[model samples]
Target: MNRLFVMMAVLLAGMSAYAQSEKRIYTKAERKSAEERKFQKRMETVMDSINYADAVKALEELDFVLEADRLVFKRGETAFVTSNTNFISLSDDNAVVQIAPFNGGGPNGVGGITVEGRASNIKMKTDKKGNITFSMSVMGAGISATVDLSLPKGTNRASVTVNPNLNSNRITLGGYLLPKERSSVFKGTSF
Candidate 1:
């Protein structure tokens, strides 16, 4: 009876040891790769579920106003609202531009600075992923600016690059171009 008891105890101990050893230790790289694979799979599923045709149609019908948040200049970044009150409204045919200091705010902000322009010679293209690219010449106030804008489908965000003929520096702005319904509440509100 003692021998039988000892054999059973040995078997249980061995089984416990084997169970503990079954756990595998993963390296940091291996874990990261596994996470990346999971992320890719999730992205793939999301991409597949999206209706590309609908997205393209929505982008083609885009018409909204983009309010500038930040203005990137050669000197540095500045609060767009501080020295500028600018908004770009884009539709299928024309882009209406409104800028602050309507005169020409001289090189040092002494003159009557104008920021108004109208988009002409507009060219628009779209990619397979429903990203729209628009290039146009905005001419006004005896000055011209090349405006390049990108709008992604099914999103409220847009990116704009404005290269004015008078300045060597290019200004880039990013902001939301939400529908009129979404932007109305924020009208007359300042930050």
Candidate 2:
């Protein structure tokens, strides 16, 4: 009787071990699905790395365009604007800031004012975790403003604040900062 009981215990243990091992074996469809998922994950990682590098290069070179998806005012008011017509671009020391929100027409024949200025007192900083902060004073034909831009780690999305030197009202732009080649912004006539 003891021998039979010992044999039964050994059999049960073997069955359980087999069951666990069997769970790891994938069917043909399951294996293919897993492979595809792994491939997608790898591609996403590679793409993210490339985008992060591009953003870093754009910022360091001071040649980038910021397409504002939303315009935020100091009073907490927000307005959605067309990216192509409303953008802030900085290339070398030249900065062009435009805000055009019209389906028909407004200012500059597009919607709003397009101010082209010279960026000065430029300051750029990068943190250990790969975040960047940039600030400069822009003085031009119609506006004198200080622009502060922040870019988070591993992404091209940015928030930039434009504070005019002589006004209490400030505008913040939330958008993506991209190299000029990747940017799809349209320039309106400068005011």
Most accurate candidate by TM-score: 2
> Please, what are the lDDT tens digits per residue for candidate 2 over residues 67-108?
998999899999998888888999999999888766536667
TM-score of each: 0.51, 0.78
Error of 2 at 49 (Å): 2.2
In model 2, the clashing pairs are 107-111
Q: RMSD for each model, in Å, please?
A: 10.9, 4.0
**Which candidate tops lDDT?**
2
Candidate 1 lDDT over residue span 1-191, tens digit each: 99999999999999999988857899999999999999999887666435333333433565555665555555666544422345555555445444442333543242323344566777779789767787778776544788887777655467778787887767666665544333431222111
Residue 174 CA displacement from its true place in model 1, Å: 0.7
Compared with the true structure, all predictions reach lDDT values of: 0.59, 0.88
Please give the TM-score that candidate 1 achieves against the real structure.
Answer: 0.51
